[model samples]
Target: MDTQTQIIEQIAPYQPWLTLCGVLVLFLLLRATRRALRRRVDEIGYWLLGERGRLIWFWINAPGVMLHELSHAAVVLLFTPFGFRITSITLFRVQSTTARDRYGRVVRSGGRQSLQLGEVQYVRPQGKLISYVGDGLSGIAPLFGGTAMFAFLYWIATGYNLWDIPLDAHQNWQLLRPDWPWWTLIFAPYLILTVTSELWPSRQDWTGARWFMVGLCTCLLLALGLLWYTNHLARVLSLSTFMASRIDFALVVLVVLDLLFLIIAELTARGVRH
Candidate 1:
């Protein structure tokens, strides 16, 4: 085989992982961009509606916040010690914390001064706190829940199958149509904003989950190594053809659309300010 052909063959098995990483990088970039533009967006929102607009926006997105906290609460209730005797639950905690660096210095370089955070609190089963994985699951319950919520909302807003979008990016996008009522056009934005904002977990959310993430990556590497060692690489590679392909396609659709809208909003805000 030619060098290029041999290279392609070697990478074929790991293509899914590499593509996933690329998507993650892009996701982070877009997240940071949205954050950077947030201050300006808020300013514009206030300018347009005065002092009450911020409050109005906050209440408008309250459903998303409620959904986010409820997701966490549900997980806690699910893993109840005896399946029903729950002791404590906090649906939401919103606070503002000053930004600081890794060494504890105030991070004044960033445009903003502090961060507004929302949290969901709940008690774990008495003896079930031994595993970091459990904490990890609890911490990130919103992400899984938020993704599912977004899929549902996306389906409602566009009437497309979330897990069945066309792999060919150009295809079917033009055919998109929302079968829902006209009022959806008003409420859908708030719902979508809530879902998207809640999708990115905060630093506190990753504290216990970091080790669990490390364990997952370690296991993934080991599993792939074992597959290669056992001459089952081809089978593992075929996983991309299964449900993964559908999920990836759906995510691509979501992320691209998010980037497009965010960029447009940022530009429009800048234009209005100038």
Candidate 2:
């Protein structure tokens, strides 16, 4: 083989793994962007409504918060036969508590300064082996649930199915050109905004499932290692690449939504102050 062909042959086998890693990195970055946009929106709300701003923010994202907590509850209930029990489901509560860092240092210590949007309290069976995986699934339920919600709302508002869109970036842009309905223009933004804002799991959500995550990661690594040993890794990785391509459009939509809200907040802040 020529030098160029030799290089291609050497690097081709790992291409799927590279693509999957790239998609995961992009997913993490977009999630951070979503969180920052949420904080910016809250800041604008405070500037516009003062002490009542927190309440306004809560109500604005109420639908999403409900869904987030409900997703957790649903997963917990799904494991009910496995000895999981729901203690309580709080859809909305404004609780003023001292905010602490990961190390337990107090960050905020006085007044009504925190909002507890929603929570699902559940008890896991003490001796059940399956509870480990169940806990992790319950913790991560909001993400899967939120993605479904986002796709559905997008379809309703745009009359276009996000999953049905071609994976080609250029083709996707071309497909987005059609004018949306008048009613969509009025209500769709609010609906999309509410859902995306609360799509991620909170720190507390992850904390309770650390063991489950560690165990799950260990199992995945072993499986991947076995596949690599048998020389079947490339085929499996190809599937990863395909799945990554499917989410590319969804990530792009999220970035666009984040930018849109950030722009609106900045403009409103400027307009209000002047």
Candidate 3:
């Protein structure tokens, strides 16, 4: 076995009990929190069910949409003296203004070019060939920004560690890793999806792309849960050999599924020409 597999195998024996305890603690905590927030949660749920309330929620969160654009603007400033100006900044709206710099260049290619919040726009340069760099950087701002954020958060929580071992290591019914922090487990799936979404191609024509991404993320989460369950079952049954083999296989399958969905999404996005 490879080094990683060997290490995991060495650690596997301690996982079952630890995972179970972690689950029990997480469940109790969540139950307590739910009880505390029951009324407010119910009220918000009722509000979200109303069409007008849903629309208002979207509007209120609209400024988050500008984060990708702001990342691009920051990148632009690194390469050019001409700075970007945010014309407006509110929870519902963002407007930006930028001028060409002497250091930037223009491209004459006929790719889709427009000034959307998270899109790459090609502008004509006054005389230089370096202008397209800023646009290219802006176009990919979301991927870089989200990746940086994810990495930073992960580092802060885990201190460059690959895994965390739980305080309790005697229970064997839980599917999540015991080593990870409870907060990390809760938010990891969302982080994964957001990073994946940023890296994937943006489809302007097919509004279904966002939903498709959500579905893909859901599938990945389910796959991960299944894999964890299988491992847990193997441990509980003392089927170490089978567990060792199948866990790796299941991980490979999940990776393949993620890649396939990403490829299909990118192709679908590129097919939209307008």
Candidate 4:
């Protein structure tokens, strides 16, 4: 085999294991952080309007809402600030005075009991081409931010290299070891949580984008499942190994903690929105 081909073969077996370990670690860190911030999670829901607020605060601090508005403002500032007048940028909504002719609305539900909705009405400017940019940017800000954060952390931890293998032209077997940084092992769980939450499915009117994201999530879940299966299989194949014995115990603890934070965030967001 050529040098490149030989290198690829050497690295392939360990890739699956590395990816799975990273995911498991990331999930744990995120769950732990969520639990630590239980009170803050309540505040985030209030900020998102997931729960009802008395008066002004309801409009001001709604969870995940402000990011949406700032996204709009940012797009306008970058692309078309000339005609776009940002009237109000709040947590849940963004208003622009310039584009009065165009109309768009998005409604989101938090279970059957509560709903959160937003409408964007804009008049097309003299140049109609730039009108949609602001809307699109605002819609996907959370996903973008979350993914970027995770990637940044991963790069820092891994030195952006998955593995290292040096070889001479003779095609002889060279050093074989994963070159992951130590910090990656420490913060793997946080990275997984951030990426997963950012990539979670949400209601979007655009079917193409929605389905694309759904597919991505399915692939990720499958990868995680395969990792778990491999670990179990390894244990079963061994006569007296305890490698997979703790898998169930670890999973149950993680799932319970994950579900608790999810419920709290949903409830808080609902209360502020109402």
Candidate 5:
């Protein structure tokens, strides 16, 4: 009868297959997306930061970079029992002079490496084994930290939380305007964009968390399979009431916005190159 009900009935039979196919497609697409996003970040960094040991470029993004590094350290501190000590946090690097390896080959003498950006070095007690989940979360803390930063800025600018941001873009314009401090309108978006762009953990960060993510993904697939077999998947995912929920809407909006921005950035960078 109803359009929603008709759609649900049509999809009910293929729920499990759809789930599997969706997962497979997403897996492939996500890898491509990440690569494109990273490439764009590199391009933008090069264009804005410039080639060479440019100290000014690093200084421009220093605040975001510092917060990004600190976030990694914060996770260890938050875990309580983990009791890891943060050894060092490098914000940016000075000009690195040319160096040689054993064969006296030239290395990355200058550029992004020279800027250093930021790093959080940490260490745990000897022989103290950290669980995979803990290791993974600690490495991914910058993602959480960046989200928190966005939320905080949203509150400061609009006197409300990010979740309060209306789904309608036209209605959300007021959130950009501050009643007192006008400069926040300019700075907030720029800071958020910088921090958000860096939210993706580096390859080294994933090295520690790779298996953990794999395990989680496996478990999730199992659960999804079970739900599909029981024919509850569609109902659970399509709950009409949940569709209108603010928090649910906020999470979806945030994810969509992130992906959309990344795709746009990638296209823009490619266009500039051409």
Candidate 6:
């Protein structure tokens, strides 16, 4: 066997687990980048505009906020047959409001009202089975939605379709320097910045689906364990690897965008301080 084949053979048994760990690391990196970027944005806004800087921050990230809410609304609509109903969608919040949980119970954080930049309200299903699946899917909609939007915007800005592109880091880096239309050069950065800023699901977004997610993961682990015991996991290794590759590609794109914007934010903040 060739060296590449030898390596694959050695690692084949662990590929799925390795891929999972790799994706998790990428997510952590994305999260760190987002927090740093947000902090920089906040600093710049406060330094230059005072309290009103919050408005500036919102406007700059308005596209992302809208996209995030829309993702929730879309998934909720998809689960309409399961009794999901979209009651209200708010793109921007100019006023404070009382917070409520997924079960409509009052939520108090240090006895203070909540501030929501954007929101999507949906009625939950009464059936436990459908509710679990619906809530889990709805909670993760932004991740799928943002990835799709980011890929689309990337294609528009650079004439490179992320789906079609190979996952070679050096070649992909070169593709980033595509000859751009003047308009794209001026506008793409802002659009990308806004979209990526809100790409990750918030704590509230994950709250409704946490238990469901845990159960789903547990089921998956049991299934995988059963397959391994039967020595049948190899039968599905190709499919798993295929799905893992696509997911890794999407995560890589998100992480790269997050890093680019984070660097821009950091540099901008430094300049502002000076």
Candidate No. with top TM-score: 2
**Candidate 3 residue-wise lDDT, 99-169, digit = tens:** 22334444343443323334333233543434444444455556677556545544444444222322235
Q: lDDT (CA) for every model shown?
A: 0.64, 0.78, 0.44, 0.46, 0.63, 0.78
- lDDT of candidate 1 at residue 247, scale 0 to 100: 59
Clashing pairs in 1: none
What is candidate 2's CA lDDT for residue 183?
73
Stretches of model 4 off by over 4 angstroms after superposition: 1-73, 91-111, 115-127, 141-143, 161-188, 199-274
Distance from true location, Cα of 28 in model 5, Å:
13
Lowest summed lDDT window (length 10), candidate 2: 168-177
Off by over 4 Å in 6: 1-20, 97-114, 166-173, 176-185, 235-256
The residue-level lDDT of candidate 6 at 28 comes to 80
Worst 10 residues of 4 by lDDT: 93-102
Q: Which RMSD values do the candidates have, in order?
A: 5.6, 4.8, 17.5, 14.7, 7.5, 4.3
Off by over 4 Å in 5: 1-57, 94-115, 125-129, 165-183, 239-274
Model 6 scores a C-alpha lDDT of 0.78
Q: List the residue pairs that clash in candidate 5.
A: none
For model 5 the TM-score comes to: 0.58
Would you give me the overall lDDT of model 1? 0.64
**lDDT score of model 4?**
0.46
In model 3, residue pairs whose N, Cα or C atoms come closer than 3 Å (at least 3 residues apart or on different chains), thus clashing, are 17-170, 17-171, 18-169, 104-130, 104-131, 105-129, 105-130, 105-131, 164-179, 165-179
Provide TM-scores for the models. Answer: 0.69, 0.80, 0.34, 0.34, 0.58, 0.75
The weakest ten consecutive residues by lDDT in model 3 span 159-168
Better of 2 and 4 by lDDT: 2
Cα displacement (angstroms), candidate 1, residue 62, comes to 3.2
